[model samples]
Target: MPNFNNLQYASEPGSPTSPSEDWAQATADLIVVLDGATARTETGCSHGISWYAEHLGKSLLLAAADTTLSLVGVAKSAISRVACLHPECDLTHPGTPSAGIAMLRPDGRYFVLGDVAIVAESTDGIAVIVDERVSQTGVAERAEVDHYLIGTPEKAAALLPMKRAELAARNIPGGYWIAAADPAAADHALVGHLGLDDGAPVAVLTDGAARAEVFGLLDWAGLLDLAVAAGPLELIQRVRAAENSDPLGAKWPRNKASDDATMVTASVAS
Candidate 1:
């Protein structure tokens, strides 16, 4: 029964006009982070990506209150709970609201679905768990989108077809599993237990903040160190600075110029 000393941070990259699509929530014994998948095309749900993420995050936290439930079971329960909230929405639509998920529970249990991640520091070294299936599924389409600069009309056109292809492959065998309309996708998450020394550091990150590592700003260890030292918000500030330096994707060549970033930094209580 490990308790946590945790700090959560989130920021949307572009305008402050709209709410962030990313969400992070935590209790004394649980931490969850979700990166709402940006819908490039029409999604059947009118509640939008942010609404779905908020509801799903709350549902997951509620489901996780039952310590007996496995992480997969919690995910499934949460997904089903959220689904029932909006029966009128066309959940079967390929472009319906979805998200990448990362969670940490007491007893050093961690789970990751889609591209979100859980990172922990152990005596062995830095350990990270994340599902890269989504990245692997949209290769050719992603390559096409990567050819053009971010935010350009050409890039938008390329992104449309890529998003369509990705939606088609999502939650299907040989494609990727995410927190979406299907509860079965929960079974595909990467779930495991790590042996963490008492007071060991852990972090859950959405791809937006994790992309700092992808963009070569810091490795996992360094990211953890930064969060431990300056705090999680500083890590996001660094990511924002990096993104500001390369506003056009001339260097990083990512799908968006900047994304909604969220991170939760915590430590096992001795």
Candidate 2:
């Protein structure tokens, strides 16, 4: 078996202070990333996505600590706990706060929900683990907004409407799902294992941080290299720098100018 190395991590909001809505935490054997969705309209849950993400992360960590619970079970426990915190709010609100989750554990098991990702580097190249079902969603407003030029005022103007549409499609048939008030969403999560004997490196990231690679700024190999050499936060900084240079999103079209970013890197062992 490959001797495991230390796990390192970094996280930052797209902007200052409002609490980024992106959450990440790592232990010697456990790593997790959570990306909270932006609300289209105000949901009854006044706690906000950032607070929801933070609470959910804590609950998930607590759930994961229970050796007897399966990953799905852990997700259920977390969801239940978070839901309980907002009994007075409409948990079923279309705009209810939710988050995508990506986590790795000592058992070589991996769990994924929504767009948060886990990329594994092997001798051959890189393999990305993502739940792409979100794309298959047929939300017309989102599709229409997606057709707009990114970084343009038109795209910016359409965001709220598009977000409203996204909510309509979430957790429903033919729509993408995430960790929301319902624990049932966890049943829809993706779970699997990695063999540590190969000593492959895995990088767990929130969508914002992974956007750099998506925008072609860095290849998977290059991203991994930078993470090891300069640290994961550098990758995010580089992305921010690139974004800064093109504040208008003219060079690269994307939904937002900046996003909450987080990354965790580790070499797993059996």
Candidate 3:
């Protein structure tokens, strides 16, 4: 059996709210993390991002309940429904529109979208599966484009035309996975999966917690070693420190740049 643990924290860089992130876990088969996109519209439907994230989390939990669909199928179904609610935007579009998802399954099938990072460690060391971030759009240039994922319904309605045009111009292909090439200034979107099997443990982290800086500043490998020796909660603390420290952050910069952090650590038993 694979043993796992997860933790999440959201710091409201703008809103009065403490955190704008959400997470879900499945002991029997899967683990997921969803980050709400910044809203750009005023339709009040922009809250749709949160609703989408939370809804996806719940859908995953419930779909797994059916014990029929694989984790991928469950996620697909949830995403499909969420996409339906906001016809203005489509999940398969080219831009880094609004949502993200990462999952680890019992069969060693792990899938991810957005800029979340997943690390698997074993005797082979560590294999990092990182979601591509959208390329940087520049601090100044972004202002002209409205810097946020649609949040409220009104915003969703209002931004639909602009977003649609943007999508059309980009020639967004239908059914493409969504993601950011650079979470900070993303332009490209993504969705993909990788197989994991080796004599080791697995860890998945949001961009904030697993950036190159965290690894350089704290000896990420050493930290992972310590986490294995100590436990997930302590490892969670280490990630927390990385977020606060921004040890290697100079390499990666963002506009609305506060990252919601989440990390899941697991061991594949012999």
Residue 228 CA error for candidate 2 (Å)? Answer: 2.4
Q: Which wins on TM-score, candidate 1 or candidate 2?
A: 1
* Pairs of residues clashing in candidate 2: none
Best candidate, TM-score: 1
Q: Please list the residue runs of candidate 3 whose C-alpha ends up more than 4 Å from where it truly belongs after superposition.
A: 1-18, 41-46, 66-68, 83-97, 122-124, 136-176, 179-199, 212-215, 226-252
| Model 3 vs truth, CA RMSD | 8.0
lDDT of 1 by residue, 1-270 (tens): 678875555555444676788888887788899989988898899899999999999999999989789999999999999999998999998888998888887578888998898888876789988788888877899999999997799998999889988988998889999999889999989998987888888888888888879998899999888877778888888888998899989899988877888888888885
Per-residue lDDT of 1-270 in model 3, one digit per residue for the tens?
543443322222223364455454546456666655544433224334555567667766776676676555666666565556566644443443355667776456676665566666633556566654322212233333344333334434545554444333332333223422212211233334444453355666565555433446445565456555665446555555554454323333333234555556666532
Q: Which candidate would rank higher by lDDT, 1 or 3?
A: 1
Task: Tell me the spans in candidate 1 whose CA falls farther than 4 Å from its real position.
Answer: 6-8
Q: What are the lDDT scores of the predictions, listed in order?
A: 0.86, 0.81, 0.50
Give model 2's clash tally.
Answer: 0
Tens-digit per-residue lDDT, 1-270, candidate 2? 233466778888887756798898887667878999877588878789989999999999999888788888989999999999889889878888999998877556778999998877754457677888775664566666666666567787788877766777899877788999999998888898765444567788988888878889998778877886678889999988988887766677667678899998877665
TM-score of each: 0.97, 0.91, 0.62
